[model samples]
Target: MPELPEVETVKRSLERLITGSAITDVNVLFPKVVKSHTPGDFKASLAGCKIKSLARRGKYLLVHLSGDKTLVIHLRMTGRLVYLEEKDDLPRYAHVIFYLEGGKRLVFADMRKFGHINLIPTAQLKNMPELKKLGPEPLGKEFTVQYLQQELRKRRTKIKALLLDQTFVAGLGNIYADEALHLAKIHPERTAQGLTGSEAAGLHHAIIKVLEQGIKNRGTSFSDYVDGEGNIGTNQYQLKAYQREGEPCSNCGTIIERKKVAGRSSFFCPQCQSSKR
Candidate 1:
């Protein structure tokens, strides 16, 4: 699944490639991918509308269009957005295609069929069921150390589970969670409420640091993830703990280990990330 950095990278690329371009036509080959409106309505709302800009909330992509309509996309598992020239062949699993006036087409391909698209009024975007419940975006100014401490203080669950809660901190997935905790030197299984003031502060800094680094590298691409331009992310090469099971830790040379925590695979250097309580 694409995390915050991957989604943000996609938003930037899409903004550059698709913004200001008018949607000449829209084709929804997979009806299930359209969540809110039917394919006919989706097509009707988008036709001839110019894309104003692109933004991201949590893991969702917001394509602001003319006429107060917004196209919301969630690249759930294997979704990839690619802008292809007229001469290029459509990639396999191309479920949605937006034919632009400039002869370039934006293709949405998802092999798992778990990705989604919805057309909603821009005015109602805040009230959308998914967007309404998402917590503050980590990269936004609203997410500060004080904010993270308050949210963590309320949760009795393991630190790993609390970080996974989208309502508590938007845009963090399993990959980033493990990486952030490893960077902070905090055990994933430590109780959220048990974190000391210093530990929380370290975690706050580590979260921002890891995410910023991920964005700097464009995002981690362990599988098929890529930006809207089909470019692979370079952050995976920089990961220290996540998916580095049995590998020596970058800092202390301790062997990194992986285990199941909250039903997700978590990686950490046991020597470094000792339990706080």
Candidate 2:
């Protein structure tokens, strides 16, 4: 799953590659990938539209077209957007190809076929279910310590579960959540209500710091994530938690441990993060 950093990286890459280019054609190799309308309608709606800009909200990519229709893409698990100078052989998983005017092609490929694309009217974008439900972005100004405390106070869910909740804090997925929690020295199993104001403040800082660093590192390429240039991210090399199951903790030298929290694998050092609530 490409979280905020990964999605942000892709948005930047796509913006550079496809902005101002006209979509001369759209080939939907997988009909299931088009959600807003039939594949024909989706293709017709975007064929001649010029891509004005590319932006991101939460984990969704927003490609703003000239006529105010937004192309929304969620690279759910294994999806990637690659920019090619020329089409020779489409990747085995290429599901959607947007033919550009200059012979360039923007390809969306998903090996697992879980990604989705929707052509939406920009006027209705704010009210769309996905964007409407997202909380303030952790990297944005609205996500302050006071705001985080308000959202977490009295919430009985585990801290990790609360962080993973899209409505609780937008743009966080498994990797960054565990990294933030580990940085804050908070146990994933601890209830949100158990956190003190200082703890919340620490978490507030941790979230922003880790997200900024993730973006700087081009996002963690734990799986099949890549930028528009077909480049694999190298942030996996800098991970403090998330997959170093039995390795020694970088900060305290305690053995890094893994457990299931909120049905997602959590990585942390037991010594660094106290589980006692």
Q: Which candidate comes out best when scored by lDDT?
A: 2
**TM-score (all chains, Cα) for each model:** 0.97, 0.98
RMSD of each: 1.0, 1.0
- In candidate 2, what are the lDDT values of residues 102-184, reduced to their tens digit? 89999999999998999999999999998999999888889989999988886989999999999988899999999999999
| lDDT score for candidate 2 against the true structure | 0.91
Work out how many backbone clashes candidate 1 has: 0
> How many angstroms is residue 220 displaced in model 1 relative to the true structure, after the best TM-score fit?
0.8
